[model samples]
Target: MEISEMNLFGREHIKVFKNRPKAITEILSDGVQQFGEKVAVATEEHELTYKELDDLSSIAAANLQQAGIEKGDRVAAVIGNRHEFPIMVFACSKIGAIMVPINVKLAMEEIEYILGHSKPKVIIVEQEFTKKVRQAAEASGSLEAGSRLFEIEGENTFSSLLEQNAELTEAAISEEDGAFILYTSGTTGRPKGAVLSHINVIHSVMNYKYVFQTDDTMKTLIAVPMFHVTGLVGQLLHVLYVGGTVYSMKRYQNEAYIERILKDQINFLFNVPTIFIMMSTSEKFQNHSFDFVKKVAFGGSPIYQQTFNMLKQAFPNAQLHNAYGSTETTSPATLMPVSYPEAKVTSVGRPVAVADIKIMDSEGNECEPGESGELYIKGPMVVKEYWDNPEANLSSFTDGYWHSGDLGIMDDEGYIYIRDRKKDMINRAGEKIFSIEVEDVLKSHPDVVEAAVIGIPDPVFGEKVKAFVVGPSLDPDDFSMLKEHCRKSLAKFKVPEEFEIIESLPRNASGKILKNTLKQVGGEKNA
Candidate 1:
């Protein structure tokens, strides 16, 4: 379908699409009936057919019920990319429970915060990480004495739990009911759960199906972390919705990723540009044949034109797409049409058919074409609210539209180009690093007086975290000590890659850190 045909709103400038499933369970049930024996999902360890997927998920639901889980309860999972991850997600949907996919790389304190905020009735974790979860549970003080903790790996594990229960009767679920609560760092430096509904996820699935032109013949390789919305909704759920096969890896290993693509004859690849760069530069990439690959979609971080051109040469037959969205938008709010790779290479493309995008000024007035402003999105795919966060809701949403906090401009032709971010968030190789979160950790140091963090341009990772600090000492060893302090509380990706000891940070009269000045200072220091 062409973009013009899919645009449901005209001069009014709103976007919408039709024919979304009422609930995610409908997608699961329909997939089973339509593609019963077809391979649905494959991991390094196991593969499941559509019918088998349905049966296993139902069994998982029964097991949860047997453990006292019921509708409206929360189930948090800290497992990696594997067959059980999606199975547990579907099982939660089957029983009308909310799935909370926690980032496995999160530190104990970060995990504790989410556990305390969500108060999940159960937490399913990888065997190796059970101790961390247990610590988090203890720290959060939210886990009841009877709360279940299921390890995904071991003899009596996630798989064995499935075998113990029979198929369960699917619960009646509403389109508006919460399906997943994806946690993202807020401006306040704490993570807020973005509550995505069943309709929200289905809307995203439809958007992916329409934009990617996916069908039953398509075979996808998912190397991105399944806990992230890009991999979960954009890759896994989208492929499931279209009755295609999904080959997932536990974690992205550069060499293994290339091997899997060639081995499985993966036709569709949706990942960030970093993986694409790694694959293209690898000796194995040039030696192997990618003739079977048909489509390549990338997002999460900016893609350089050089990398884009290299990718085109690597997969000659593939159609390249640049997509843009967030956890709040389910997956993609905008996708660059395959036709615009050359002419509009830098733009994030127009809003998806079902999503409305507007660049609004501080006064809430829509900006004229070519003018930059904060991006606001409105659609069924947009998240309803941050779970239990009234402050976030009051600040983020206005007039039924969610403020994206991304500064962008739309050309007269309707293609959107990202200019800058209004929020103090860093995108390092597709991993989000909130500056406040990092700064909070840095300032906790005994010797630290003040800290300011910013994103500095990096050729490989798009942006790398850089911190400027004013402390009692400018000693080089002190920088290492501060980094170690952050390591205990922050994810590896959030740790500042570069640290500069400055006398003082640039600030305005009102005491707000002048980040633009810091960017300039960063550029000068690098120069």
Candidate 2:
């Protein structure tokens, strides 16, 4: 079958890449020479021009060399969305060190698992999270009980690069060498490390640049956590790849402050649905100017129609764009123009350049037009492998296509619509929550015989968790106590909103609870 028959999404937006780049270093080396003296990264602390970024990266590379880090070494960055974050990634690429961006938003135990598996030579973390880093290190026994962590604040860390020689190093990598190790949400099992090659990294970034028509004139605000591929690939990596300026935000909770900042010089934005939801609903957005903000790209999860429509209301001249991708694909696999209000509201758009998408049924049979099924992608931008994980690598790919594990349908016009997750993962405020984890916790209560977890629609959190428990001796008032138990054991976000004491759970012959049956009977209401 042709690309169109297999992929419901349009083929025009997909970018084809010739897997060649050994590293993304050249994007920076050339960008600095051309856009030198132009602002490349900015935080409240300091601003770096493209030349200075080039210089700092060289220095950081020198430090890495002196520290015994070489080709294929894993370099972890536990910092937030600061200027130092991008610098470290570029520096790692220079010396062939795979960049492993640790999610600072995750719990300490979650952080420990990533650091342990990645085996980073050294960790660059913010001082605020210094203790957490140390704790995580201790938890994993990877570093000394008390390992000294490199700290970054203002331009202080960049000055460390100055202390070293700012000499460039020759690339010692191939297209197959690991360029990045991005951890999955770990919603089900432990997080899997998706190793993206340099060529894959460059392909995804270049796709973002070309598709967005980004240029030196384009300045994007960086608010999404750079630890995720969406943030690293779309906001930080793509900016350097295309010679654009980045106004960095350490955290995005302050919607008003972010709007005040983006109100000024930004022409582009790459944020998740929540970021736009907060901005479009904020009082600050009520008065924000959009003279420069052009293409506002959003992904990570679905956005509500209310939040989608408000974006245009706030930015009368801005065009919305939807980017559909996963950690395994760097950032975007398909990007459809969300220019029209209706399109922006419903479709996730079309498959991006070079991306081949197919929606298949349970038996791997191709779904008909407008039929929802498991989404699979094949492209140069696909991850090379899961680091040190052959079993995961084997399971991840089928006939050279990466199984996205997401249920989606393609329309006649190449517009993709997401239905649900195949793995029973709950998207709570942009964070993936494994239903099994919550179920395990609830089942541990001894009184509960069977438990099933499902995501109920929430206005704020794309989906709020609601667990239905099938057990004896539980009253309506007992739910508060059960919820409290969950609070003590799991993350607050993982705790269920409400619980129903059902006589019995609906189950198939395989003994698997039919969660859809639960949703049919009053589960469609609120969590």
Best by TM-score: 1
RMSD of 1: 10.7
What local lDDT score does residue 80 receive in model 2, on the 0 to 100 scale? 80
Considering summed lDDT, which 10 consecutive residues are worst modelled in model 1? 2-11
How close is every model to the real structure, measured as TM-score? 0.79, 0.76
Model 1 clashing residue pairs (backbone) = none
Model 1 has a clash total of 0
lDDT of 2 by residue, 149-194 (tens): 5767533353565566545665677766787898877655788999
Clashes of 2: 12
C-alpha lDDT (0 to 100) for residue 112 of candidate 2: 93
lDDT string for model 1 (1-527, tens) is 32222311112333444455778888778999999999999998989998988888888898888777888899999988889888998999999999999988778998999999998988898988888888998889856645577887753477666885455767899877899999984324788899988978988998888877888888998887888888889888989999999999987888999988888899999887657856775899988778788899988655556667778888899988898999999989999876873878868888988677889987889999988788999887888899999999889887668898888889999999876567656889988666756776786675665678999999999999999987755677877887888899998888998998888776422123668789888978876
State the displacement of the C-alpha of residue 424, model 1, in Å, after optimal TM-score superposition: 5.2
* Regions more than 4 Å wrong, model 1: 1-16, 154-156, 164-167, 185-188, 424-527
